[model samples]
Target: MEEHGTTQPGDGTTLVPGPGSAFRRTLLRRMLPAVAAAGLGITGIAGVAHGAAGGPQRTAAADFPTWGTRWVVHADADTRSPAVGMVNASAPGKDRITADYQVDTGRRVCEGSSCSSYMAHLTGPVSGFLTVVAVAIPQDRLPGIPVQGAPPPQPGVSRQEMLARAATWLTADNGAQVSYSQAKVWKDGYRQDCSGYVSMALRLPTPGTNTVGLATDRGLTRPVPLGELKGGDLLIDATGDNNRHVVIFEKWNDAAHSSYTAFEQRGGHGTDHRSLTYGLPGGDAEFTPYRPVAFSD
Candidate 1:
């Protein structure tokens, strides 16, 4: 049980939607709402790039034998800009590309034996021509494509190991706490938020589960009383919104239990090991304690 309560300063970060940027508008109007319904919200943007392959509908991978790639023609030819649009291999003419869509670059047009189609997102709007590439899917491999929002399989972990994992970001990258950003991921591929941090500590699948998943997913965690919170447990404010926050419980401050020590990755503070009153009487009442169901110890 670790109980020190001093904060180590970490860089603060923010995302300013670019004015008149088509990508920003498209992301806000199209991708966000879809991803939100998928239980990922805005933070899921980073994970989508890594080939979490589900879409509104599932098509048999066998139906498509070739994946399409296109070069973005824009004002800045030297600086390649990703063109964002819905890819309809079946569509004719300009009917295919419209609005903004986040493309999952991680899921290639062809994987060993399986194949999947992908969409690409432009960081900004650029007017130019497109050069399309048709890559044939290798026939030797079997079809095994992952759907979007699907988490990869992982094994259980011990409490000591979990805490140790949590401690790494405190001084990760030579004494720099992993910078916090919903739009970004740490070096390990986990989002840099409180819930993401806890997910990393618990050794969950990459990009990590969102706050709602951590609190409600029976396979990940279960409700536990504040009095019972032990090392590696969690205090999550699962509001199912952008304001949600979570912390890894280190230990209680005293027998009275007015506060406790925790590891949290917060906006403006990054990863921190400090005292928190989240579930206490006068603190934010939204926080509820939970225990990871995957704990091996």
Candidate 2:
């Protein structure tokens, strides 16, 4: 057992404070072993654990299982800031920042032939200490060269099924809200952006393709007239990196086809199901409606 004022978690050693500050240091030296033997854990003390001499020292975070299992981390001591570390749920322009990540225990992040750290996965956009928001793991880099490209899209995904998937992000039980982020991928392994959200709804592979891929991939979607748009169609603007965006067309808002309701993952807003006028007359001309290739219709 190593002797120290305070220890890290699971070290089998800890600091026991006394009534007087002077006595604290003096009493700890004498009582540490007894406390360790008795397995006494006193709150408010940082515990450190180490193996036998020439053995390994494991951090509490390191001890946590990586892949599959979900973990929550805080930004500060008070547990107030949930958006920290490799996963950030903070909305665009929000000052909240973090690197605390949800990781796949055994899987490491890889870039081409070069692999470095563990990959991050997140559960929600933003969260509290107890709130299990979207799962976020550390993604050392955005557009990371994933060890494997996204698996092929699931076949025969229905429009209703796609809408149900999109609804998950809107429901309170599903994190009540998902904060917008381009750099982070959601627990489901899709990018946390408009195109990513649509990919998730479309049952595309993890770490989904970008807006351009969704819009231009003839095998993914085909251009359709605005009047022909249906429940699971898309209104995408695939012009350029900075100006590109997409939304999942849910249904027409009215019989007139003047406006429509859609699901969109946009900046500032994580995931939203709302009415839109992107392709309607006098609306944003950049948007063009399209039908996913997977749909039977």
lDDT of each: 0.52, 0.51
Among all windows of ten consecutive residues in candidate 2, which has the lowest summed lDDT? Answer: 61-70
Off by over 4 Å in 1: 1-156, 240-242
How many Å off is the CA of 233 in candidate 1? Answer: 0.5
Cα RMSDs, all models: 15.6, 17.3
Off by over 4 Å in 2: 1-156, 172-174, 240-242
Per-residue accuracy of model 2 over 1-297 as CA lDDT, tens digit each: 111123224532222111223343234333333232122111111122312233223322211111111223334222223434322212311222121223222323221222222332322332322111111123232122222122334733799899889888775324676667664555454667787788778876544667888888898999988788989899998885347899988889888988999988889767888889987898888898899999988
lDDT tens digits, residue span 36-141, model 1: 2233233323233223435422322211112222223322211133333222223222222211232233322322222223332222222321111111212111
Count of residue pairs whose backbone atoms collide, per candidate: 6, 37
